[model samples]
Target: MERTRNSWKCPIFGDLNDLKDNVLPTYGDVMRFYEWTRHRLKYERERNKEPTYKEIEAIVVARLIEIWAKSSIPTVEPKRMKVMLQTYHLKCKNLLKSNPRIPKNTLEGFRLGSKALFDIAACKCQEFLKCACPKNKKIPARERGFITDQRTARQMVIGALDVVTTTKITKTLKRKSIRENSKSKRLKKPKHVRKS
Candidate 1:
């Protein structure tokens, strides 16, 4: 029998599906998802505290279920996942552009495939566990923070790929935005306390 090849080359969301189904998540799975948390939340890494093991484990079990659920798709090929992500990215970008008031900074991460994967991972983890997640019990402060961070990071990454430049982003429009922000900060001070 010809053994099937693995599609772990998808970078952010590997199609491992290696974890056992209907079983508790393992240490390795927790660690892997934690690393993905880092990948998706790169921008907020500075202020956000590192996630605890229980926090990751809480989400990892659903991830295992999500992965295993897809195991029957019969589609296991490298770069295939990447293409699917790109297609979805384009569709989302168009919808987001309906309003011009939104800032472009959030779009930066969307250009990277990692952002989509990060987003999908977050969604899949929660989606697969809708039935299992407690309906009445209130979530702890820490896990709530984790959920918020995931959404914030995904929003930051949802942007147009066309805007992506070949060079590293050194804040072209960001400089103007910073200046505007600094000016606004000064406006908040009472006139009596304002420094000429």
Candidate 2:
């Protein structure tokens, strides 16, 4: 009997090599190809009228499913997935516009393809138990203070030191004057006050 291609040398009985080699293309390769095609489409679209948003969305979702099927990454966040799919769809729409031979019927096909892909991505994401990220999450607000700059911080410290020194000198001077005034009052008092 003819020996089938030794799909693997490992003692394992499973046939994953065949699946990798024959059944589906690698995810990276497919995504790269898609990106190149998208670039071409973009260049073409710029010279022509752009596709509608709905049409663009459909194209992207469909392309995303194709990418997801082969990707090693099992789960994709819903928003990121949508963004990825949208980018591809817009690119495809641009490509289709440039091609003169593809019929109106093909546009309908693209729409259907997009919807099917969107549904598939949604189902897969749900199965994988991914999180729904908050829309409001953002970069933290900047701190408000005089300490933002090292130079400013140093200047502020110097200013504080000057205020402290001025306050101490004023207090010392005030105490000395009060003591001198009290001594003068005692010296001016009559000799009858000496008994006290």
Candidate 3:
């Protein structure tokens, strides 16, 4: 009798319910929700191309820079923020590779867009700082929270944008070169076939 109840409780009415009602709700749910949102945004970008992955990545980096720039020291600490942004950028590249509508050249365009956006932001910041540190001035507090100095925050935002843009351009160019090499090899193969 006890064994029957224990068996039923072991999974159906027992520990599983407690976990489902409690632990799972606290941890896995939130993490999965975030992942789902990320994937959703990725797919939306893939479909519309309005917000390219590079743009998204640059925006995030810009936010990071803005947060750090506001600090008295004006540096991105904790290091992990940089790592996560790079990881997300890589994921975007992989997603773009699988997307048929995202042209090879568009990848390059995104790279350029990121750099241009960063440059614009940085230039604006610098202009504001002609008296001193303008880079720290333009950071919108809504993006980076209320913790750091505005000028430092703005600089950090540009730095983060630069990092993502540079990494993406390098990766895309490497892929483009490989494709070109493959094309050249195919041309050479046709010549050899004619000789044979």
Candidate 4:
């Protein structure tokens, strides 16, 4: 009995037969890819009890290659993975730096930053995917949740920052009160020395 080789089927590119043979993938393809990966990651976390950093990286790289191969674009090389990942990280870092409301020190800030990083990663991935096939297209309205979620996360981070700032201000005010009370006592007028 001959063993049949199983062809890898990409959730995003498996059914894009209508696309021109030479045409690159559109924004729709990238968005579908992102959603697929997000679901796969969630499933992996639930089933395998959370993958380590290295495991996660391997999964992302593998998925990227699979998507590229399935797209039938001859120009996109596997070597581009490293560059794409680096660009993604750079974009995330720049986003974090540009937004001053996301606190870097608090737990809430860290959570918000992580969300922002994921949001930027999705954006960068889409950008790279679009470049691979060079097409002018707008993301569909139904798939615009990425933008909305990022905006909501930013607002939440701003709210968290306000809370942090208020607490810090209150602490400083308490310290100042103590110091001011001591200074006031020291500056009190000396008892009147009556000339007896």
Candidate 5:
């Protein structure tokens, strides 16, 4: 009799090793994780106050590690996870910086930032899960008719984020458009004929 070797291991759950080959994480798991994190952060804020960036970063990193470990991929390394988290953090920060109308101290700004982070995480998780599985193999959930495609998953994340931050995004876009339109109008006006 030949023994089969399992290549995948859950970093957070040692007991999951036995089932790693048989099971894989689903898109639903990613969504649920985001929802859970958002609610937990909200509750914590209500009880105490706004958590510091370090506190939020710690929570985000821990949750990501747990989620990735639960997936079919083998061994979510700390370095890779931290790099991913840092990239998303920078993206969210840049988004805020670009949208000057959205005051960072306001409740709306905080909510938008949280939503953006969740969106980034969800998109990354979907891409990672889709590509992690071998081409010849069907995802565990896909075989059961869960029917999650990469494009659809990405679009869903983007749409959800858009819905949440539409006002802020649109306002900034409108301002930019108006500025551009005025600049174009000025350029269109022929320079007054300079007669010596």
Candidate 6:
């Protein structure tokens, strides 16, 4: 995520490897541009033109971003999670051990990232925040439950329109550079170092 290939604009992430350690995107984006781009890029790369890239390159890119988003979690509501863990401690009377799926010690770091993301998502789903997600202002309390659910579903859909997209420039570029340096280097170890 850069404004341009290489510009004065600061990049969203400092390093490519940091992507996995960062947030995860949700699943089932109906309008992911990558799905289309995957094929198109493959076609172009075969011709040796850089309009796109495909095949193994495309697979790697997908692995780099969506894999984490789809496979694992990126921290969830943490300030909330802390409040939850603390409440757990109080309720269970186990201050030292509360069986948190995520421990409280890492809460500081989790708070920093999740606060921003949670606020963004929460703000959108709020009673009214002026986001792309529709606002159901002044609905009856009795109907608010379903209305809220509907709004949330709409929010996810609207947010996902052409949303699942990213360029793994850093990784591929680094790989190409490494290839230039040493041809036989495998990025990862084989399934078995020794076969039976």
The alpha-carbon lDDT assigned to residue 95 of candidate 1 equals: 36
By TM-score, is 4 or 6 better? Answer: 4
Candidate 5 lowest-lDDT run of ten? 11-20
Which parts of model 3 are misplaced by more than 4 Å? 1-47, 76-83, 88-196
Between candidates 2 and 6, which one is better according to TM-score?
A: 2
- The TM-score measured for candidate 5 stands at 0.32
Clashes of each: 2, 2, 15, 0, 0, 1
- Candidate 6: tens digits of C-alpha lDDT, residues 1-196: 2222222121111221212222332211211222334334545557644443224334434443453233222322434433433342242223224335536655444333322221112233355333343332233233334334433442321122222332354567688898876755553535567778
TM-scores for the candidates: 0.22, 0.21, 0.21, 0.27, 0.32, 0.18
lDDT of 4 by residue, 16-134 (tens): 22212222223333323433444456464565454443444455556555443332222234345545554654544464465556444553443334333222222223444353332
Candidates ranked, most accurate by TM-score first: 5, 4, 1, 3, 2, 6
In candidate 2, list every pair of residues with a backbone clash.
60-85, 60-89
Q: Largest TM-score belongs to which candidate?
A: 5
Between candidates 4 and 6, name the one with more favorable lDDT: 4
Local lDDT at 76 for model 5: 36
Please give the CA lDDT of all the candidate structures.
0.40, 0.40, 0.39, 0.41, 0.41, 0.33
Considering every candidate listed, which one attains the maximal lDDT?
5
Model 1 C-alpha lDDT per residue in residues 1-196, reported as the tens digit of each score? 0113332322223443443433223332333444454334432455446555445444544554465233211122224334443455354446355535545554444334333223222222343335343433333332444344434452322122323441223465577789999999999977777678
lDDT of 3 by residue, 57-164 (tens): 454445445433433223433244446555544644464556667577765654433322112122233333242434454443343332222223323222224567
- Model 4 regions more than 4 Å off: 1-53, 101-196
Distance (Å) between predicted and true CA of 134, model 5?
A: 15
Could you tell me how far off, in angstroms, the CA of residue 127 lies in candidate 4 after the best superposition? 21
The Cα RMSD of model 1 versus the native structure comes to 22.1
Residue pairs in steric clash, candidate 5? Answer: none
Better of 2 and 4 by lDDT: 4
> What are the runs in model 5 whose C-alpha is more than 4 Å off?
1-49, 100-196
lDDT tens digits by residue: candidate 2, 35-98: 3433344455675444455554445445555543442223345467567655654556474556
